[model samples]
Target: MTIPDRPLEIIWDITYACPLRCVHCYSESGRRPSRQLRRDDLLRMADAIVAMRPYGISIAGGEPLLVKELFEVTERMTAAGIQVALFTGGWTLRPEMVGDLARAFFRVSVSLDGATAEVHDRVRGRRGSFDRALRALDMLAGAGPVFGIDCVVVRSNFGQIEQVCTELVPRFPGLGFVSFGAVVPEGLASRTGFAEHELLTEEQMAAMGAPAFRERLRALVPPGVHVTATDNLALQMHPDRIREGQFFPALQIEPDGAVRAMPAYEGTVGNLLTDSPAELWRRSVERWHDPFVVATLTPVRTVREWAEATRRIDYHFASAADRERIDRRPAFAQL
Candidate 1:
């Protein structure tokens, strides 16, 4: 398929500061990173985003609530007529904050790893995190902005997928959808050596995409609830689509102001603060020509390629020399 002229969506990791240390956090965020883009810089980038006019932008982070100027940023974006989505762990969401978000017409997607407190809290690495998240969901339900649940499917909570869809999701009044993201073994997952233990095996991932399992999930998911799986590439990357070529419709802005074609991939296209969003986006599209990016984007081919890409990308970020190489390469060079 031909690539779109512009991105359909942008996912920005506005800050790398988070309150919770989830076992599978792709950013490995906890305490605020020592280096982050200044508020003025980010606001300036927001201005550029307004100029680009993507259909939607998802503001995310270790915990977006930690950003002191989050509300200000959201208001500016909303006032500019850009649809914004807030992706949070929900630990810091307050009634007043929910009200603000609702007024801005921002959509919220809260993380919920399991159906029950015990299961959820265990993954979040906090004892009462599940309750806090549920409370935030309740507040958002009545606050008026569209909201949904984001669950990272891992070995610990895979069995509760049904309960999350049937029991947990239906209890929230304004819940719009439930997205199941396959746990990617990157970031903290790799650092802690939990990739092998926590991530679903290749066989398990394939099983989740099997016709019978998908039908089971379909039957169990309640009416009015839409279910989406981010890592269900086995079902999405059809052979024909691969042959024809496909493009992912989103770009990501990291907390430090770097723009990347894919969040998990370590290649930086540009910095949102110093570079125009349009130019960065153009580079993101051009970077697709890189063999590494092509392998990362192409799915249902082999688990080994995916694993190696993740490892190499992770290593690229881990090494200063590698990052220097990226900085020196041409804008369209394979990251």
Candidate 2:
């Protein structure tokens, strides 16, 4: 499929610093206060990102809440008529903060790795994380913009997925969505991350890999609740849901005033301040044949591959849903 003309979503890591050091964190989310994006740098990035006219901006972090100035930045984004989404662990949310976020963001997403505190705290390497996350949900429910929860599907929680769905949905009927993300075993979580027992085994993956699992999960999802799995996780569905909105401007300005290609791909891409955002983007476009974007975007075809593989399975989830409710299907599918 051809890349979308404009990015459909842009993720702005408010800070790389996070409160918890989860074993399976992809961004290497940390609590290094020193890495926090500066106010001026954030404003500049925001200005450039808002100029891109993407569908929405996702504000993420080590924990966005760690950055005291996030609300201020969010305020500016809303004033600029930009839609925003916040990604947090929900440890810091308070009653008043929810009201403040409701006016600023389009929606909010919090992470909860397990249905039970024992499992959650162990994975997070912090005590009371699960309780705080639940409380955070209470504070977020109905008090602000729609909010949802993100769970990292692994061997430990795969069994509890149904429980999480059953327990959380009726508990907070106003949630915007629930996403089951496949555990990305990289970075700090690669070697020393979750113990072997915590990781999903091949057998469990096979069970979750079935077309029926996808169908059943969707059926179990509450109406108006979104359940998204990445192309890498469950490929038995539409390509657009997995790949349509995958691209974004591959540039980010760091906290220390250094300009770089995406934050995740920092260092490999030259600095923006030293080089020029426009020049970098142009070079990046010219270097499309280079590994980074091409390599990353190539696998997205998996989404379509999955959809085709499971075409025989009843696509009750896709066919019955309102077209407007779902993301655009892969361009090739329209062909």
Candidate 3:
């Protein structure tokens, strides 16, 4: 499928230098060693993305908060009337920092692996990350801007999803949503952690491979609260919602200003600093047919026409359980 003319969201991975070294990090490429994007280069890319007029922009990173000029980025995006969302582990959400974040954007998303401190801290590989994340959440609560939490479901935290919904929803009643990204078989995640039982098994896949899993997930979340599953998980588990009326949704721009159709693609769509939004859109549409990307994006195409027409690409699923559920949906019945 071609890239949407109007983007639902754009993700900016401003830097890759995170404080805590989580085992499942997708940006593991940064952990080895990295340099931050220059201020001028980042500002230029922001201008290009604003020109696209996307509904929202998400600035994330090893931790976006670590970047010195992140405030400028958020200020600029908001000044342009583009809604902005910041994705971070929330380890840095100190009182002073929370005030700063509240002024810069429309929403702030803090990562939480588990509802309790024990599960969260262990997953994040830091002593006090969970406490800090909650502190951040507390700091942001009832501030003008919306607040949300993001987490990656791994074998370690898979069974805790329900608890998270139950505990977090009421604790932070103003929280707008919970965002979940199932483990992607890439970067550091592919390497370490878990036995098969700990992971999503074929049986779980078969049992949960339908909309019921997501619906149940919705039920567990606080009433009226929203939820998002990024990447392939969104493809298999959330396609119906995306199609029903949600939105085209997020994109990712790397430090080099390359706009990926999604954050994980990591290849060049076009340099946001130099190219016009229309040009980048055209280029992404062109590249969508590349055997590689087509296969990656294939799981989202339900109709035979879509599948036959699609060539190559990869997809994201939130968990083995989510993928199993996704595979079982009746989307392909007509196909």
Candidate 4:
């Protein structure tokens, strides 16, 4: 495969504030202090993003809707001809907002963990979240945006994905796809106490990314609907992707201004608030070759091990001023 000359996508997590604390949350979202930039910072960051102009940006969040001026930043990026996609928990997505979301996002994805409200709400840690999500889906149905489902296939939701897709397909006839994913051990899921009930086994994680497994799931869905299992574990296997500084194939900007190639790791290449995204990308390319990155990843033979390895690669800002400020962070440590 040809290595990309530039990033194909920028996955920007606009805000770290959310309405739910889902059991498998990678960022421990709602539990952490808010990482959203101020309105001015977001605008300045938007300007930098437009100028840098990677192929597209996926605007993800703890829940993007929580941000008051979210659309203003998205509108600016889209005006500059950058394609945008959105990811939300669907808690605050109003019916009126559906049309605007349709206009701004190339595709909008809403998370749903299970087929029934009982199962979905349990994963979400909110009593009425399942109803709100389904209500949001109903609001989006045939509303002009190409919409889809994002399901994290943990032990509880694993058996329900086929049902999640089949049951909803008729209700929302044009739903794009049901994207299934396994958990990454970080944030709350990383804790030994919490991992037992939800985390997948080593074998389950392997099978989740297997082509034969994906195809088998696809076979169960309707002709118009697509079923996909996310396969990012393969990125850890590709030395070229790591060597090229495209380990994620997307530049990840955490809720704070810190920009990183990989989110599971705390090593930030630069901050969008004070640095050029393009330069940060180049900096990231340079850092991957560091002996520690290779040494740490070499022994990670399974998805669980890789997830653990992710948090172990700690990097700090290059600016001396930044170094002083970054060292105090709870997430950062010397490797």
Number of the predicted model whose lDDT against the real structure is largest: 4
Deviation in Å, model 4, residue 290 alpha carbon: 2.2
Sort the candidates on TM-score, descending order: 4, 1, 3, 2
The superposed Cα distance between candidate 4 and the true structure at residue 142, in angstroms, equals 0.9
Which tens-of-lDDT digit does each residue in 99-186 have in candidate 2? 6788888888888888889878777768899999988887887776888988877666777887777786557858878877665432
Ranking, lDDT, top scorer first: 4, 1, 3, 2
Q: What are the TM-scores, per candidate, against the unseen true structure? A: 0.84, 0.72, 0.75, 0.86
Clashing pairs in 4: none
lDDT scores for all predictions? 0.71, 0.59, 0.64, 0.73
Better of 2 and 3 by lDDT: 3
What candidate 4 gets wrong by more than 4 Å, as runs, is 1-5, 194-197, 235-247, 314-335
Per-structure clash totals for the candidates: 0, 6, 18, 0
Model 2, residue pairs in steric clash: 17-30, 17-62, 18-30, 18-62, 102-145, 259-272
RMSD to native, candidate 2? 11.9
Give lDDT tens digits, candidate 1, residues 172-218: 88688888877765555433345546767777687665667666776
Q: Could you tell which candidate, 1 or 3, scores higher by TM-score? A: 1
Weakest ten-residue segment in model 4 by summed lDDT: 326-335
